[model samples]
Target: MKKLLLLLVAVIGLSSCNKDSQEPRPVVPEGEGQPISVSFTGEVEDDSPRALEGTVNGSPAGKLLSFRGKGDVYGWVYVVDKDGEFAKGYKKLKVSEDGRSLSYEGTVPTTRSGGGTIDNATAKVSIYIGLDASGVFTNKGFKSIENVGHASGSSLGDDFAILKSENNALTYVSRSISGKYHEYKASNGKLSFSMAGSLILIRFRNEFQSPSHKVLWRKISGVLIKVADGAPLTRDPAIIDQMRVMNLHIDKIKIAVKDGNTQLTGTNEPSSGFIDNSTRYPNGYFFNLAKTVSIPTNTNRGVNSPFDNRESVIAFYTPISKRVDGRAGELAAFSFRLQNEAHYKEERFEDGLFSMASHRSVTFRSELEEGRVHRALLNITYQHVEGGGKN
Candidate 1:
């Protein structure tokens, strides 16, 4: 009886200690993009759009949490700190409209982080990019970039654009604008108007170490693209209105020299027209020539078109000054192939222009010196952006 009484007293003491302890809650691990569990308050699988709710793993001991969305509704659901560049990838979640459940072939945010081509049923999703007390969305700075916002979609589209920003060229496009644009700011980066609706923030990525694109091209000549000489010249003062001429302004071009140095150059004059050498624009004026064919400046030397297309381009551009070749006279006349990828398109204005995110990525190869003027001879290949193969 004495031993039983002692055991009961010990049990009561243990119960009292247990009653004083606080309950522990499950949490997301730090650094890793582990899932943060939260209750989905409503019918998430219904046909109508629905917001998926969840708590970001607890941060800072007593920190408040915040959230937002990145990428399209169909892309990975990103987990990040409230303010910073977006994370590498996101969580792969199953979204459904009719309950068929559409998802990537493989769980992304693991296998791939960007350039996702969606061609299935429309995926409507809304993710809350939550922030913690420290004013960050994730403990890591992945989602902590400035100007945090949400990204959503009403359809599963093949083309997507990434937002771009820079010093002067309007780097900030509203993510709320339902489009994406890739900001090519490299020295030899190419810019395409196909991304018209989307923004292309161009800068001398080397600008941090080098001069601005403006300062770099200050001394260099712009492009001189030539289409069919037979194109009827227009008397209009606007160079763009002459789209009937089957030509466009050589905006920017990216080229890699046979010696293996990549150079990015652009137009002192934004667009060119039927005006040839006769029309005085600047030291870098593009004139429509009779037979001579050359690609525009800075384009991927290997991926432009032949000079024979009804719409061919020619430009006289000099790369930014380099230690090897300072701002000096033209280099030795050598030939390189220009496979034209971009096309001569005539678009109508006044209406909201078509929104497109142009990949327009290209490759190049060195060609032999042809004659008096040796240059790259690019075999214009049709812009085949879908098949994952060249045309």
Candidate 2:
């Protein structure tokens, strides 16, 4: 009886082992395209001394504008492998309700001919926002980022021009990914997109304290921006060579003001601000404004109040050069034109043009960085005349 029980236990153990071995194992399909999930996180770097407060129009200052509500926010995605670029398509990113994150879904090529899986395959993906499909890609389906904002015949313009509106300024961010085929399946990494350019904010402050020194602040008719020589505002190699010794001009800037504040409240202007690349101004562009911007006068309220109650500010969006060889970018020189040239002369000021570089007392040399707010304060203070009497 003991021998018989031992034989039966041995048979049961063998049977259990067989059953376990026969069970099916889970299998992942191979030799086919794989689904990929990519997430984008937008970031804006405010390099200004003081953080910007409130909003310009409805868009927050020093922040990426909301992309959800705008139907025009879209970009192209390109995927490349060892075999070169295989897939390129337009993708309209879905922005989160809060507008902080964006998401995209697509398939990554992973297989070869004859149902063979590509070994040691790598994938590279690139996404560019804030540009139209036709403007960003050529008819051959290749990316033509070199001539983004270039004039029809002019050789100069921003390679990746940022679109701006009274409501919001459109910014762009790009990201790339690369690894083995299977690694992409586990890759849900965050792609950070920063503001591809810089925001220039010029604040007008009236610092005249003495009643006798008070001068009438004239309406600003236009402003001129001359970027430093060798500033690489565009990506074209040929254009960069030509720009080495040339200054990029942004002239004929008409300002729009409401009440006493320099707020963008115009509706007749181009939503994306027109870029005039006339050859009359080489390596320069201009945008129109609805009305003239007037500067506020200093309030003579004893020692407590020195500035006016209203804020006079003008904003400009420009592309900044990337740092090369550890060198920082240069700040653009600014010159403002007054509506009444005689008013500036009457106050003993030099001409109607207020050049930021001409003032020696006010030293402002902020290194320019992409996606940062470069704030410049222009104080319309009165110069004390030797013979002029002051209370």
Candidate 3:
């Protein structure tokens, strides 16, 4: 009869909808933790400026090198709720021996009791460069971040505060630079994630060999990479697709300097070559003058370059994107200090924005001069099939 036909059609439609939705796979045995294995093996999009491989001032301008990407790559899995937000708990993945893969084995918590079936539930996976055991995530790749505890599956919004440690413990926490964002799925026990974003490495130094202080410790207070106009910088993989779809452009970035409170904006001036010069940046950006290192006489590396002292390199990681400048490239920002200025502890900084066409070494003076990949990235470089070949 007509009534029977209508009921059958409704049942079929409901089944079809369930099939299309991101529902959890059939549950495994109660105690058998769902095995979630994540592997990272893919080429990140390269938009750094090109460099000619030749001699520069009688020295090799370009040297072949690899990329030993800073920090340990991490994988985080989050459970999603029906409202399209992070729910329940998340698992911190373990890195493989080769550093290309991350894995986690545990029951996907779907109930308050901590042990329940994931059937009909949703899962999201996110992969990122660097590791932070601290519950919160920051932008200073391989550097210390705000000491805070954010439980798994917590909703992170656009404006998150990074707190400074009150103690004098110089504990260093890794900042996650480029992240693969979030990938959602109704799982079947196994999951895989790939990373294809760009990396931003920011290094620091004292341009002068001598300053007026005993320990002219120049430090980068913080680093921020904004991808969209209204996206939350979160580790939850479930909402990555939403943020990515919102916008993949670099809206703004802020890198707080040590104490000068300087803001450097990029300019087309020919004199803007690298050294902290004022004339090059007519945009009214503050440049730390006093072009000499201000450290203890005996502790000074004495050499003008930071590379001479292995401790001078302060690396960072940031997501890659089609730059807002229309060239569709990656952007980077830097924070610096000259006298152990505690800008980070005070949180007194104004974010700045800038772009780099060429993705070269940030602070390795010899490597920058020779155009070689810094030793930090020696094991992770790849030759992008663009203009010529670039890392």
Q: Who wins the lDDT comparison? A: 2
RMSD of 2: 25.1
For residues 45-118, what per-residue lDDT tens digits would candidate 1 score against the true structure?
12111111111122111101111111112222221221212222232223234222223222112111343322
Instruction: List, residue by residue over 1-391, the lDDT tens digit for candidate 3.
Output: 0100000000000001111221222332323333322222322213111211221112122111111121222222334323332222233334344333334443333332333322233233332222122222332222211111111111111111111100011111222233312222323333323222222222222222222121111124543433323222221101000000111212123222222121112123222112322354222122232222222222322122222322222222222223223333332223333333221111111222221111122221111111111222211011212222111
Best by TM-score: 2
Residues 1-391 of candidate 2 have per-residue lDDT tens digits of 0100000000000001121321232322333454333333332222321223432223332121333233223554444444543333455555555444555654433333443432223544555554444423111100111111122111111222332211111121222355332323213245545443444444444443222221223234543233223212211101000010112222211223232222111122222333434364333334333334444345222211222223334444443332112224332343343443223323322223331111112212343454454544444443423333221
Give the Cα lDDT of each candidate: 0.19, 0.31, 0.23
| Residue 135 CA displacement from its true place in model 3, Å | 5.8
TM per candidate comes to 0.16, 0.45, 0.27
Ranking by lDDT: 2, 3, 1
**Clash pairs for candidate 2:** none
Superior by lDDT: candidate 1 or candidate 2: 2
The per-candidate count of clashes, in order, stands at 63, 0, 28
List CA RMSD, all candidates.
29.8, 25.1, 25.8
